[model samples]
Target: MPALDLPFSLLDRSRTRAGEPDAVAVRATVERAHRAEGLGYSRFWVAEHHAVPGIASGSPAVLAAAVAARTHRIRVGSGGVMLPNHVPLVVAEQFAVLESLYPGRIDLGLGRSLGFSAPVREALRTARTDPEKFLRDVAEVRAYLQGRGPVTARPAVAQAPPMFVLASGAGLTLAARAGLPVVVGGPVLRGPAPLAPYRAAFDDGPAAPAHPYVIVSANVMVAATRGAAEELLLPDAWAMAASRATGAYPPLEEAAAVRRRSLTPKQRESVEQFYDQAIYGSPDEVVAELADLVRRTGADEVMLTTSTYDRDELARADAAIARLFTA
Candidate 1:
């Protein structure tokens, strides 16, 4: 088999299982990173989700520190840290510290999302929803990282870690104006039309890249058979569907349990929609689909955000993806 020409990476949300403690999920994320480094994956990223029972990685910087310490080569970073929930200087300092310790292995992927619910947003003390403010904050964070801010961020390094925007909707424009690379997924992946404007509007700032870069993220799974791969996606799909219907993102449950639950039509539709957005199949099938996705989006990299209840199966899936490129 031919190798996938571009780099591929992993993003672990540290998803908790039904009976497991949150710590287990966090540790699993670190372990997954270790395995990913050995498997020849390009980067390993963690996410931030506050007060969510299903995701244990509320502090991406802290978790990234841990992952960085455990691995020697693979790039480690947040996929990303929510900008609305943080101060620009603080965000700069945290990543600066990570870069100080790990050198070139750190990344800072930022997003404008608030907490999952109103109360969580209240707890975070972030009510700002203005897109312009988010753009300014992103610029401020970049300024600090690049040593151009009025007040210098501490522990300043020779070079700042690279930054990326977790883009959606108007986020493409924000990233273009800010001149940062983008990690895009979800509805935007249905077609390639949205990326054209971003490329056209891209600004080549001092800290920005000369050209627009896109990383296509998705829930991808590979197994011995198509049915088996789909089964692995059930837990995450069910969790997403349940979260939408009940307003609570629960820990991942077994596929058999998900199969046993009788769902309302709306919930069933939600589950199907989740499946529709994902790419999962046997090895050959997945390679063809991912190649098609790269062709459509012109992505510089592919980031897998796959999660499942069984840790071993998840590991196997990661190995399978790695083999696709290495073989």
Candidate 2:
């Protein structure tokens, strides 16, 4: 057995179920995380998003704190906190306080996007937006975290956690040069082209840990049968496909509801194609597919995330992946 180093984590978008008459979604989210922790998964991360009806992880720091307090061993932190949406000093103060409470277990993954639409982005952005603000902010954040400055973090602030970059495009190049871990992936469908560039850009200099680390979160959903898995995942795949086509955020609620209704022949064809290229399959089949992805990207650690809302399916999927690592 290779030992499961997949270090599965939840990249929660924070949307509740559309029509379920139960309150299990939120509790299930908590329990699902706890189960991953209990299963010896490595890290548990929540993303920072804003103004998306389907996403509740608008506050990664607060959510991270709750998840951290609930679980004991698993590393809990933001898969990212959208940096441009915040002032770096405020970001520093929030995370420093988190680190103080959960020493040696906090991680701060930063992304430059506002993580929302224009209006939402504008609302979240403070009155300051300099062109080189990220660089200046990052430096300030680094200083505040390292206790190297007189304007130290306040309000129960503590040591800063490891910083990472959630990168896409030239963002990878920047992360490497700046000396931070780069998350080469997330919810969107992926292939070798993007991951290769991200790996090549890394430098492993003083800004990063002794060894370079790359974390990629791939979309996956496992069910008892391939048909069932594909059936359940159409909404997520279709939503992404729509986002790709229009460069607009798809209505997730509408997308989810689409699954329960009959689809047009064209839409069905598109969803089927999407499943073929992205994620949709039985557990064993998914393992074979993802192992190939690992070979292509040279990912040091991969976190298989389920964008679908099926807790049992995700659990079964994890067990299947865990078995491979054991094998």
- On a 0 to 100 scale, what is the lDDT of residue 283 in model 1? 88
lDDT of each: 0.91, 0.66
| Clash count in backbone of candidate 1 | 0
Point out where model 2 deviates above 4 Å: 1-6, 20-27, 126-132, 155-159, 186-191, 194-203, 239-257, 260-277
**lDDT, residue 23, model 1:** 96
CA lDDT for candidate 1:
0.91
User: What does candidate 2's lDDT look like per residue over 1-327, in tens digits?
Assistant: 244345455565544555553234445556666777776677778877666545556788887887788888888878788777777778888888888888888888887775445677568754443436665667678777877655767744444689887876677766766567777664324554465555566666654566556776676776667887776676666665555445443534434477676666666676666666565576677667666766666666666556655556567766555555542
- CA-only RMSD, every prediction: 1.1, 3.8
lDDT of 1 by residue, 1-327 (tens): 566888999999999999888999999999999999999999999999999989999999999999999999999999999999999999999999999999999999999889888899999998767789888998899889989999999988889899999998889999999999999999755655378888889999767888999999988999989999999999999999999965668999999999999998998999999988899998899998888888888888999998899999999999999887752
lDDT of 1 at 69: 96
